[model samples]
Target: MNNNCTEVEDPYIRYVMSQRPFGWNFTDPPVFKPYEFEKVDPFYWVSLMEDNWKVAFYAAAIYIVAIFGLQKFMENRAPFELKKPLFVWNLSLGIFSVIGFVRYVPGFMLVLSQPNGFYRSICIKDGMDLPTGYWTLLFAFSKFWELGDTFYIVLRKRRLVFIQYYHHVVTMIVVWIVGPLVEPISRWYTVLNYGVHSLMYPYFALRAIGIRVPVFIANLITFLQLSQMIIGFTVNMTSLYHQQIGNDCIRYPVSIKAFSLVYGSFILLFGKLFYDSVIKSGRRQKEKKLL
Candidate 1:
């Protein structure tokens, strides 16, 4: 391997790789590698799930029906506390997200630091690198498990808001579509989601266990979610621009459109929720305090 990036013609790639941030060495060999077994690979299994669109659609259909059906069934029954179980569930997800964030992000940053790394990361197959690919595959599969979040809400007789269910449904579909594709741009979504979940789930777990977190912390988490959507939408638009210029970027027209629509709507929905729940409510409390 030449290991010399000067031959690369793309200016963007050269510029990103040359900037060493905070004394981090981008040229160092990767610390992690993809896992494999005797003649079998787990990442392949996750990739295979995306081979058929019906599988994702069917899963989404079942999810919608089950949540609504369970809601109706619970209408006549007393609400379940489920405090302990919910605590454990949230804690587990929090830990998983933390691990994912730690594992994938450094490697991605390292990749970006290499010669022509930005271009390689975006345009090359498996350009996210092996470790990222492995973790990302797991992240995709984990979305299905996260559907349990709604189950807890329903059982506790909490109101199932449209944003809650809509987030779950669309996220599942989007992860399935883009996860296996492993487009370099999709890495931004994975990293953002993992970072948010790492904080959000632990907060949920603490609250479930009777630890009273400040209200502002909850509002902060919601703000982070909204920010993630905005950033994701911005990234997709950038990718679209690169695709238009024929910059050797992987072009997934349908996936790009889906992401734009989903993230764009999420921005609006989350903005409203944040205003209603945080800003408006905080102002009311301030007025009461004054009185």
Candidate 2:
């Protein structure tokens, strides 16, 4: 991490620094001449996200009803073989996630690369008024589309676990809540999610296309999910510690608790998932072999 990052004056960093919405007067002076503020990154993203976070809650409700309704509808019917559609769906999500990861990870990296980067990255409100913000917006909206994943599960007569739906519903709402603010911790959350989906979705695409993905590879995906949950939990606790000690960087104690609870639940859910799929399944396989 460069203590004098402002001194380096990299053009890319300059551009990103110039693009923050809530005014970062980082010496270079965010000029309105050649690089007009609107041209660099639109301001409407923050407004739209902050304004419409409630939409996520409504969407989640609709998603819950639709999934259960679909499940009941499909209970008496033969499962449709929508292999190609599923393949396309997973592949599209994979590509979308990869693009988001590519575009947004660097913003957080840049945050950490700056002086006091780690703390500032955790505390500051680097609003979404940059190129990275666009992808971040898409990442949140993508949750709405992700509800379709459950539809696929229900229609296919696959078991739709509580963790799966619960995670989606809560995530959709929370991402919307924290997205516009782009809280330092939430920034990390978005990056981790993009990274995980980047790997997980492509693997799903391969399976969707009838390719024989290895069991170990599937286990690895679950492992990554568990890792994400643990990391999220740890970060929330760290943020809480900062709050307790009178850190003026952010004032989100209740939000932090909510985030912690969500991540903690995930830790339990994904841990059980890993145990059932990996550890217990491995034991069963060993027992069968011995038999």
Predicted structure with the largest lDDT when compared to the true one:
1
Clash pairs, candidate 1, are: none
Candidate 2, residues 165-276, lDDT tens digits: the string is 9999988887776555455576778888999999999998898878998899999999999999998888778777777798856635546767887898889999999999
In model 1, where is the ten-residue run with the lowest total lDDT?
18-27
Give the residue spans of candidate 1 off by over 4 A.
1-29, 33-43, 114-127
Reference-based TM-score of each model: 0.83, 0.82
Worst 10 residues of 2 by lDDT: 25-34
Q: What is the model-wide C-alpha lDDT for candidate 1?
A: 0.75
Error of 1 at 125 (Å): 4.8
